[model samples]
Target chain A: MNPAVWLIGAGPGDPELLTMKAVKALGLADVVLVDDLVDPRILDYCPDARIVRVGKRGGCRSTPQDFIQRLMLRYARQGLRVARLKGGDPCIFGRGGEEAQWLSAHGVACEVVNGITAGLAAATAVGIPLTQRGLATGVTLVTAHTQDGGMPDWSALARGGTTLVVYMGVAKLQDMRGQLLAAGMDAATPVAMIENASLPGQRECASTVAAMADDADAFRLRSPAVLVIGQVAACRMYGAPDAPALAETRLRRSA
Target chain B: MNPAVWLIGAGPGDPELLTMKAVKALGLADVVLVDDLVDPRILDYCPDARIVRVGKRGGCRSTPQDFIQRLMLRYARQGLRVARLKGGDPCIFGRGGEEAQWLSAHGVACEVVNGITAGLAAATAVGIPLTQRGLATGVTLVTAHTQDGGMPDWSALARGGTTLVVYMGVAKLQDMRGQLLAAGMDAATPVAMIENASLPGQRECASTVAAMADDADAFRLRSPAVLVIGQVAACRMYGAPDAPALAETRLRRSA
Candidate 1:
């Protein structure tokens, strides 16, 4: 068997979301290095492979990325079909680029299997069309957390005509509100926060930017939520309008 | 048996890219309304269904979106499991939101199955990461063809730290190049155009903004191509450089 690495995106915890290529890759893997966000039940697809949870949970003692890279190389060198499974699309925010670059640098054959990122999944669950004609022509995907707490240029994103999806942004609503408001984005811009997207118990807190902080708290939205902001976010789902006046309601970010 | 309308994303022309959920939904459908971009071969999954092509191709007599919605309603009202298949993720650009909303307005049960959008598929096909740590903090998905040919605010996008993917952009690149250039983006910013992503005939043309007009003219890249711009566009896929000096070198949009 040709020993190469397969970087697979497990697709936001829904096993059925796995692509045919991902299932095939799992079947071929000799060992799988799974991140924390990956649904544990997904490992059953590769019953024959050894499973290693190399991911560090948020704010916990976690595996260093370099160590994970070294471990992948070690197994690949041993003629093993190594599969590194991340939570969503490997290209989105899971550090897949650095790992892919490392594997390429070492001359290991690699194939990246894309999956539905959490952002899209969250949008579907919340019933917002990410890019709508005449309403929003563009959608931007960014994370609330960045390397070393470096900030993203929120002002640029506040420009009209685009929707924004912020992954892992539950903790930054206050900061984002301040920055975006200062950047002149209307305080009434609709915001939809979807938690546990695609899962059975998923919840959504939809409101305008000015009230999202309080809405999130009142609704108890948690981590891993995908936050959508824009006119499209104000859109009512196909059949019924939930909180039809959400955009007009105002509340401060609850500390 | 439950009669419901399933809106499925057929993904970017690759039969194998269909998600497990999409396949399952296809199998349950009694009728399918397919868009032009979807590969016809994928219909085999639903052997028992009657397939209809309702897509309006560009520059040709096309099916009106309202007519398509009426057709979906007729089928669903008849208690048939109807599938509306569009190429790429339906939510990304396919007017899926409007369809789903229409169905809901009529009180018909509809479920949206997310599929990979063409932009992400193009990125994977081109071997460039859409979002890389530090290099690209965010990624934007937009379409060049908008209703009424109105313009998106190009000045804000010129703010660095984002990678842009423009769908149906071939016709608009020269215009975008001008707007973005005027908006203060670096003329040397990298751009990679991917045509027929995830298909056997897939090809790529990599160059810089300043050279792209000539490069696209020389290469003859056609519609359905995805344009990736920003620092990530300059990224060498996570391996040893395939063409180390691709940006400086000129390549026509290979047919």
Candidate 2:
């Protein structure tokens, strides 16, 4: 039997949102490779499968990309069904294509199952429309991490009439804000940061681009947070100005 | 029974991607107001329900926006369970908020069930990573439509190291290219346009942003096509030539 692999998207940390296809694959897996952002509850669906942790976290020891690929190949060569579980959708920043390409090149069959990305789920969960008529008609999903951990090109991002969503940006919130501001983005442009999105301990804070970094720190946000920056972030309608303002204050103090 | 409306996202034109929750809502809908882009196959899921075609198409005569809202209210007032089915996720340019707000103001309860957006699905189907390490750490979802049927603000969208996905953009492909070029975006930036993504007869063409509009017309693409622009668009190994040649073709043609 040829060893095969299934690449599954866990869907924004919500076990229930896992697609029927993903669930079926998990149940049939002999080995499961999961990322850090995937909810632990999903393991319950594959009680008989062997679980391996191959999650990557910034600024910490991580399983090398090449090593992970090798492990998948090795297991498949042994005729073991391997399931590579990724957070959110496998295609979005999950390096799924690379894995699939490698597997296909080595005569292994691979299938990609889609999942709900965190950016969309976070925007929906908070009642913030990523695109709205007469407000924002487009949205940009980005990350705060660069090779040097610096801000991305702000000159292009400050263009009006588009929403920007940033992933893994909590650590570089202040730098991102500074870049956007330097790029001529409005100081008052609305920004929202969601920590542990779709998880039970989820926390969402709304502020302006000028205040997001400092404010997120005060809220004590951790990694795996998603940042939504644009006019739509202001539409959360929490009914309290103090909530945003206080969160900013807390972030500034913590920083 | 108080009349309530549920707004459901149909997911990227594929009937199977519909969530179990969304399917349940459709099963319970007394009346379903579906958009033009929704696959007819989904209607099979609601054989017992009344299906209404209220979808607005670009360039074609569409039911007035206000009238659509009023129709929802009109149905709900008669104690009918209504499902407003939209192609792609409802909140991403689906005008779901306008409908939700209208319902809430009229004391009608509204529930929203999120669906997968086309951009992510398109990326997955074509093997492009929306966000990838050392390439793009971010992605932007944008539309090609504006209030006056012109291009949206392109200056802000030319930001480097980000992926841009445009929905309903086929008609305005040329305008979008010009605007992005004028806004300092590299002419060689990779772009992929997927027509009828994830469905039967799905067609995808890849070129640089400079060449996209011309080639798209050559392919005779239609509305409901998705445009993904950025470095990530170039990452897919779909047997296309590298970026420089594609950009040169676009430049020579436009010049």
Candidate 3:
């Protein structure tokens, strides 16, 4: 077979969430290029394939995108089946498009296998509905970073009636809170920060947008955390047992 | 095993996109309760299971939510292994919560298996990136339906800078466009609608938010369409040959 590249999404830290297509692609890979956010256990699916870590963590010393693209090109040129494994759905903020473009430009065939995105996984893991009938009608997934590492456009995000899921936003909680509030967002809008979603070590912190900036230290959340803001965040229950309590709390607060 | 109910997302119309956990659940189910949006091909994995069509399509006389909940309860009472299969991720807007709550209250053990949502799959199927370095920092997933089958509040959706994915919104394209424009959304925001995404008979139509309402009629799109609006929608290339042209179109439009 001609050299080819398979861009696969590993889903959000859960190996079982991997699509059959993604798993098959990994099993057939001659070399697997994995990212930092992807669970290491996923490598077990391709026991025979050589694994290489092309770590790309935000705000860390990581492999440059160009270098990673070149590595994929080089490997494919040598008649190797290369798998570029990404966290979450590759097309959703995983930079898979750039990699696919580079591979296609270099005359290498490429196929993209979709995975469950972090926003969806975080919502499920925390029992928060991204959209509900009367509570929230829409969901917005965003990040805190810009090209120059500046804050995102907060004015647009402050719009009410939309659930906002912020990835890599824990550190900027204070700034984000202030910006949203300043842009006419209700100060008491519900906010929940989920740390390490889908993993055993997952932790959740619930608060209001007004309190997030002041109580940011209480969560002790790190990178890879997801921040959900809207009425839906208020509906999150710790487990099946807390469902009623969570709903009642929201009802009381809203009343 | 004790009587139990498993709520599984069947993925967005593609059998291969089902998670391993979902597939396993289907294999073990004694009865499968499915919705209209779920691809019929998924039933192939559960050949021995009794199939129940409890589908609730919009604007159609469908089974009430309470009625559906009662059916799950009845099935579990018979000591059956029931699987409630929904299209896309169950937690997002699938009413999985109500069903799970009903099951728990009735002493039926329930577990949710997440599946790939149409928003993410639609984005990938059409080569659109929900987020990019300088283009979009966020994405929003919403449905077009309200409880009374009217338009959702567009004032909140009109805010700029987030990619918007609308499920089941094709029939209401004209109303959606009017609402967005009235709420001050930019006229040129790119929008792409994919009908039957990830399935054979898939059709994609690209236009602006302002023009989509009128142009969607030209495509004669039907149900199960996923509409994506933002700079990302411009990333889609019908075939691999138009990659550069697509990118150029995005860049030129943004500039």
Model 3 agreement with the true structure over A1-255: per-residue lDDT tens digits: 323888999988978899988888888999999999999999999999999999988779999989999999889888889999999988777887777766776777787788988877877776776776677777777787776778777786666467888887877887887789898888888887777778777767777888875555754567788888888887742345644223322221321
Question: In candidate 2 chain A, what residue range of length 10 has the lowest lDDT sum?
Answer: A246-255
Worst-scoring 10-residue span by lDDT in model 1 chain B: B246-255
Q: Note the Cα lDDT for every prediction shown.
A: 0.82, 0.76, 0.78
Model 1: per-residue Cα lDDT over B1-255, one tens digit each? 343888999999888788999999999899999988889889989988999999777777899988999999998888888999999998998888888878888988787789989999888766788888878888999887667786677778768367988888887878888888898888888899888888867778887777776788778888778999888886865564443222233454221
DockQ of each: 0.69, 0.41, 0.52
Model 1 chain A: worst 10 consecutive residues (lDDT sum): A243-252
Best prediction by DockQ: 1
Model 3 misplaced stretches (Cα beyond 4 Å)? A1-3, A237-239, A242-255, B1-3, B148-150, B237-239, B242-255
Q: How many residue pairs clash in each candidate?
A: 2, 7, 0
lDDT of 3 by residue, B172-198 (tens): 888888888888888898888887778
Question: What tens digits encode model 2's per-residue C-alpha lDDT throughout B1-255?
Answer: 222888888888778677666787888899999999899998887999999999698768988889888999899889899998998888888887767767777767676677878888877767677776677757777778775666777776675557788888887888888889998888988887787777876777777888887888777777678888888876752223332212222222231
- Accuracy of chain B in candidate 3 (TM-score): 0.89
User: Which of candidates 1 and 2 reaches a greater lDDT?
Assistant: 1
lDDT of 1 by residue, A150-247 (tens): 76888888884689999988988888888888999888888988877877657777788887777887777888789999989867555644422233
lDDT of 1 at A23: 88
